[model samples]
Target chain A: MRVSLSEFRPPREGAAAPALRELRDEELIERVQQGQRRAFDEIVRRYKGRLNNFILRMVHDPLEAEELTQDTLIRVYVHADKYREIARFSTWVFTIATNLVRNRVRQRKRQPTWLSLNPAPEDDEVPLDPPDPRADPSRQVEREELGRLISHATSRIPEKYRVPFLLREVEQLSYEEIQRVTGLKLGTVRSRINRARARFRRHIKPLLRNEALLAELEQIEARLAAEEGSDSDD
Target chain B: MFCRRARSFISLALDGALPADRTITLTRHLEGCARCREYQTDLQLGRRLLATSAPALADGFEWRLQLRLNRTLQEAARAAASAWDAPPAGAGRWLRGAGLAAVGGLALAAAVGLFLLPGEWSVPAPREPGVPGALVERNAPQEPAPASAPQIAIVEAPATVTSTAGDPTRTSVSGQSRTTWFGREGTGRAVDLRLSGAPDPRGLLERQGWSGGSLEDLRSIATLRDQNRRLRDALAQAQREVILLRAQSDTARGGLAADAGGQREAPQTR
Candidate 1:
């Protein structure tokens, strides 16, 4: 079966690698301000997937994520003069993205009910089938259950907690950077992450016990690791 | 430090967010306490699961972003170029200079025309003395001059008398004409003596009794003629001054035009 880009890359191996990559975001932004088209291209290449995924999770629509990503980059170009070194460039960029997402959500709320006939693609539908009993069904079942549980739990999270949770857990932003991006206090960010953790645990604990789900998760992990190996080789 | 405050630190410790020394202490404490230890494991597991479960974005997202940046840069460049190419301040200055020169030229022409022309002077051509005899015969009879022989027979004597009747007193006083010949010596001066026609000189003097009346009339007429002559001379002088002023005005205008032409041509020459 053909794998999607989402399934290709493994989780980041070490914390230090992302930290080093993040140090370049500011340099790229400076170059963009100086009219370096290639620097802007590099920035898009670096953050497009991550920003798209973040927006996709928030909006839950691929087309909307694509459009919002474009809008985010355009906004960065228009407002590049306003970028300051006091905050990390990634935090500033994400702040713009989050604001756009919030506005899109609000606009969607104000639109008439008839116009909203097309719903977002159902993320809850599991792609993998139930494992055979003859096979290592227990682990396969566990991974599938865990995937469904995670999707449901994250989908249910309110925007306020979901945004902080995504930034902290998925984007892996520092607390101070999250505060800058979300315009929330450090205390509030910490509490929201704690609450998101509690909610995530409540949803995932039952699914974590499935033997088949665990096996499927291990298989997914191995595939992800192999993809990462290939990417590093490239 | 306080009873309830330790819970906040416990929460922080679960997130691996406490200070280094505090983290060590918190971890040691958590190892002994099952509840805190469970909380830490739950938090770590939640973080890991959330990280893995979130979807990754589509590929080649950066390329689209770069395209957008390029388009924006182009738009900005176009705007800058247009702003730079707009008409400049020098054009306005040149227009103002041209307008001022035009107004000044018109004002100078009008001033010369309105204030500089001679007043009440009419020009007449010179006439020959012989034309008077022809003119007199066409209009009326001519009076004959006195002759030394006194033997010329004049058949137009009646016509002369009839014509002189229009000046009846002069015709009636032909006997006394020789006495006034000395008084008509000065240019533009006239003397009148009617001694023969008057019946009584004392009665004539009594009838016009104002003292020095004749002398005053002659003096007043001479003064008026002199004033008129002075006025004519002054008017002619003023007209000449006006002509000179007009010439100067024209010359100045030519100079201004030449200067402006030079300025215009300087750039071409360069």
Candidate 2:
């Protein structure tokens, strides 16, 4: 059985029959090339949420994400002839979104008002760990707090690592899909994702210093270890 | 496994990339290691948090997109239609050719008026004093000068440096020299050229095939006249063709209207 990249996505929503939505991405694009507006509408419906979230995480701006998402789709419509079936449609569209966000991020960097809340590593004369969030009585690592921290940390990671990292973890793209979307070597993808994971952990570690989650983590780890031991014994 | 290697494996395991066998070892390793366990927990927690953190798009996203797409497509269609509906190339070319010929004829007329028209040209006497307002009559050929004396042609040139046109003090170089021509504060004198020891003008004009009676010059003028006539004829033909095209266009439009009316009445009768 041949697995396609589209399998990684969730099942389509709405009462639209699987038979109708079942048109292959390449076929839909061909229909669009033949001036079928319905086919292009199907494409926009399918990729809008995924592309928007991917771009949102990359740029950390909602409005820019929406604009870039629309721009990417319009480009697909305008230059539909440029697309080839050599790669999956998801991969090609994600590549376009990545490039658009990359250019926007580069332009933002040139502006003086574009500031990151996180301090740079070079700002430290001596390597001091980030202040523990647990030390403050007012700052509890609640669900919302944790979500905010994760979002902030995700944004704080260098864009190079952040891009591939989001494509892998949040978007749930496979390693190979990430390699295709980012146009990075497989080995580079692995290392950058690993590095991004480490940085993300470091950023949120102080917040996750809660005793309850650690106790839960320990129980889960112990159960997994026992299962592994039983499988080895058998 | 070493803590560092175990951390990497744990990261891959979080992404579901680790092999099953390595997963077991990583589980056992995590069981033994507190630091690696914390690392795995942080990654999982962050991943879970990120899932819920994706921003929801604003309302009416698809509607807005549809609106933009319509406007964009309409613009593209309009541009394409204009390109397709442009006038035919042959008619435009003929029209352009006629306009260029008319411009060329006007330019040729101006050149003839400037260079070949009879003007107040006089040859200065060799002994006349070189003064600003001194006028010399056209030298009579019967009174011949010495062979060694140079023959010079003097033509009057307008002094663009000062007010010469419509000025009451304007000097006419037509054998009438106004002594008070340069009396006004801003009025300036005309320009004069006295080429001494130059070659004879008549001999030079004959050598260059531009003498008054030279056949080559007359033939060139005749050729220009013939070309002007041909261009006028071509212009007339182009105008007639344009009128014909307009008439054909109007006839086609009328036929279209009649056909449309017939179709409308047929549908009503049915």
Candidate 2 clashes between residue pairs 3 or more apart in a chain or in different chains: none
Worst 10 residues of 1 chain B by lDDT: B181-190
Per-residue CA lDDT of model 2 for B1-270, tens digit only, reads: 799899889878887889999999998998888988878877887675566545556655665564454445445534433432232347444543433243223323333333433342121224234446443222323323423433222222222223334432333423211111211222122222122332332344345544222123333334434433443344355455434544554564455557557866997899
Q: Candidate 1 lDDT, tens digit per residue, A1-234?
A: 111223222222232233344548888778666655445556665676678768877887777889898899778766666798888888998899999999999998998645557876355421333333433555445544554567677777888888988887777788898998888999999888777766766667765566775566567667668767975664
All candidates: DockQ: 0.10, 0.12
Encode model 1's per-residue lDDT on B1-270: one tens digit a residue. 332244456656655688888766665665667765565665666665655554544444443444444445445434433332222336323422332243234344333333433231111222233553211121113435544322111111001111222321121124422101100011000111111221222333244442321222223334334433443343344334434444654676676567557777999989
Give stretches of model 2 more than 4 Å off: A1-18, A23-27, A111-147, A206-234, B19-28, B77-270
lDDT of 1 at A33: 67
C-alpha positional error of residue B29 in candidate 1 after TM-score superposition, expressed in Å: 5.2
Top lDDT prediction, candidate number: 2
The reply for model 1, stretches above 4 Å from the true place, is A1-23, A113-149, B1-11, B20-25, B32-38, B58-270
Cand. 2 TM to true fold:
0.51
